[model samples]
Target: MQITLIAIGKTDRAELEELISIYAKRLQHYIKFEFRIIPDIKNSKNLSEAQQKEKEGELILAQLQPTDTLILLDEKGKQYTSMDFADFLQKKMNSGIKNLVLVIGGPYGFSEAVYAECSGKISLSKMTFSHQMVRLFLVEQIYRGFTILRNEPYHHQ
Candidate 1:
């Protein structure tokens, strides 16, 4: 199955971008992985929190195909251990999912429409993280999950 990460805005910090790239490259060895960035909305300063989420949600939804299984990275979502996450991925592949789309929403979070469209949600941690930082974290975790699945030495229990 192809795994795609869709996030809002760019990673402006060079260090973070480099780290994300490193993990993303590692992930390519295991699956067809792509990181697509949805550019931040223009004139966002004038929009309300809900309005911003709505606009971003529209853009996020547009990137998805009808067959894509949408998973949102949300604070209130289910949390899984490293090994469990690997199994979760394995199940998706076993089920013959064509595309697994995971989204990291904008600062204010996802809109109602986006929530309705998603099949499920996942939480990396209970602690809050910057959206840019989460990108790197998510990519690294995905790489680690694959390593765990293959019984590689990259992930230590």
Candidate 2:
């Protein structure tokens, strides 16, 4: 199955982008991986938090295919260890899905509509992280998960 990570906005820090790119390249060896960015809304400063989320949600929804399984990276979602995440991915691959879309929402998070479209939600950690950092963290974890699946030396128990 192809894995896609769709996130809102860009990573301004060069170091973070470089790190994400490194993990992304490593991930390509295991599966078809795509990192897609939905540009931030224009004039966001004037919009209310709810309105911003709504606009961002629209852009996020537009990127999905009908058959794609959407998973949101939400703080309040189910938390799993690295090994468990590998198992989760294995199950999805076994299920014969074409694409697995994992989303990282904007600052105010996702709208109600976006939440409705998702198949499930996953939490990387209980503590909050910057959106840019989340991108890097998610990419590295995905790479680590693949390594764990293959019995590679990238991860330790």
TM-score of each: 0.99, 0.98
Residues 1-157 of candidate 2 have per-residue lDDT tens digits of: 9999999999899999999999999999999999999998999999999999999999999999999999999999999899999999999999999999999999999999999999999999999999999999999989989999999998999
Per-residue lDDT of model 1, residues 39-121, tens digit only: 99999999999999999999999999999999999999999999999999999999999999999999999999999999999
Off by over 4 Å in 1: none
Q: Rate the local accuracy (lDDT) of all candidates.
A: 0.96, 0.96
Tell me the spans in candidate 2 whose CA falls farther than 4 Å from its real position: none
Model 2 misses residue 97 by how many Å?
A: 0.7
Q: Judged by lDDT against the true structure, how good is candidate 2?
A: 0.96
Q: RMSD of each candidate?
A: 0.6, 0.6
Per-residue error (Å), model 1, residue 39: 0.5
Compute the lDDT of residue 40 as modeled in candidate 2.
89
